[model samples]
Target: MEDFLQNLLNGIAAGSIYALIALGYTMVYGVLKLINFAHGDIFMIGSFVGFYAGRYMARHATGEAASLGSAALVLLLAMLVCGIVGYLNERIAYRPLRNAPRIASLITAIGVSFLLEYGGQMVFGPDPKFFPTLVEKKIIHLGTITTTNYQFIVLAVAIVFMGLLQYIIYGTKFGRALRAVSFNFETASLMGIPTDRIISMTFVLGSMLAAVAGILYGLSYPKIDPLMGIMPGLKAFVAAVLGGIGNVPGAVVGGLLIGIIESFVGGSQFSSYRDGIAFVILIVILLFRPSGLFGRYEPEKV
Candidate 1:
């Protein structure tokens, strides 16, 4: 039971990262009906941003606590940088293909993905860089299960960000406009909503979330490379699909489920197949219920 609890905690921590990235995927799909495959690369870029920011702050900080406090600033900078990158991605690569076939946009996204990966390698180098330890690590005992301060911190930050997102999506006027645009682009535009700006906002918001995820992920794993985003990105995509691709709440649920499942698998003898578990779940879910757990099927009008 103690072991089980430990694995569960571990699952939740990892799941928070997956959920964060998945939210980006779901939001973009909700608005554009297009997958920004380069989003994972945006995540990678955010990690590097945090890496440099954290390292620089650590050098100037007076103490461990001060260095840790710098994490908030690091997070803000990463969000701003990646947000701009996402905005540019939409404007330069995705906007032109809006009227074209879906395949064209998909191929363009893939092309962009390659561009970010190789471009990142050229810019940041192919070697893996160690993430600076911004937060001091301490172990906490909860009954029979032991956990770290870092895990709790990661979970807490993720929840805060998710709550803020919920408020933005459901509480604000801009959010109402965003939802309006997502529902029907032409109708929303006719209703005097600036559809283009809303779409750009969607990208900006999603990328910001991804940036936070990237920073949290770096804190957890501590090693990052240009290609690090690929696996996590794919798994997060599975989570999005599992929970109904365009459904916001569903993305969170799916992320937690996938994270818990992965943790359990890792704890067992089949640990070697931990990465493959996502694909298995993806295939199984696709076969049994293609619309996903929370998604209702809609047939095309002939």
Candidate 2:
């Protein structure tokens, strides 16, 4: 029971990371009906950004300086850098193809993904870099479940960000504009909403979330490679679909579930095939609950 509980906690933490990145995939897809495949690369960039920034900060700090407060600051800086990178991606690569065919947009997104991957290598180099330690590796006890300070912090940040996004989507004017645009771009524009701006904002918000996820992942594992985002990004997309694409709450649910499943299955003797768990879930869900757990079924009107 204790072992199972510990695995559960770990799974939830891993899933939270997936959910954060998955939110980006679902948001862009829901609003624009575009997948934004470059999202993984955006996450990769966030890892690099956080890696360099954390290293620089550590280099200047006094010996053995590790605390929750300092960790929070590092995460904040990483979030900002990732958010800005996501905003720029939309402003430059995706915005121009807003009116293009889905195929075209997808191709453009793939191109952008390559650009970031190779460009990241060109600038940051191809070697994997170690992330500076921000948290003291102390495991916390929670009655049959022991978790690290790092896990607790990561989970807390993921929850806070998710809640903040929920508030923005449900309680803010910008969120209202986003919904209006999502429903119908032409009608939204007809009603005085700046459809273009809202679209851009959606991308920016999603990208930032992915970046944060990437940073958390780096902190969790302490090793980051340029291509790390590919698997996680793909899994996140599966999570978005599982939770019901376009549904914010669904994304969270799906992400956490996928993470947990992968962890348990991987922890078993089948660890070698852990990466395949997400796709298995994706296919199973599509074959059965096509609309997703939290996703609404919309029939096309004639």
lDDT of 1 by residue, 60-166 (tens): 88686686679888999999999999999999999999999888999999999999999999999999999998888899999989999989998999999999999
97: Cα error in model 2, Å: 1.6
TM-scores, all models, native as reference: 0.98, 0.94
lDDT computed for candidate 1: 0.93
Q: Candidate 2, which ten residues in sequence have the lowest lDDT sum?
A: 62-71
Clashing pairs in 1: none
lDDT by residue for model 2 (182-298), tens: 888899999999888888789888988887898889989888888888899899999999999888889999999999999898778999889998999999998999789998888
What lDDT does the true structure give each of the candidates?
A: 0.93, 0.86
User: For all the candidates, what are their Cα RMSDs to the real structure?
Assistant: 1.0, 1.8
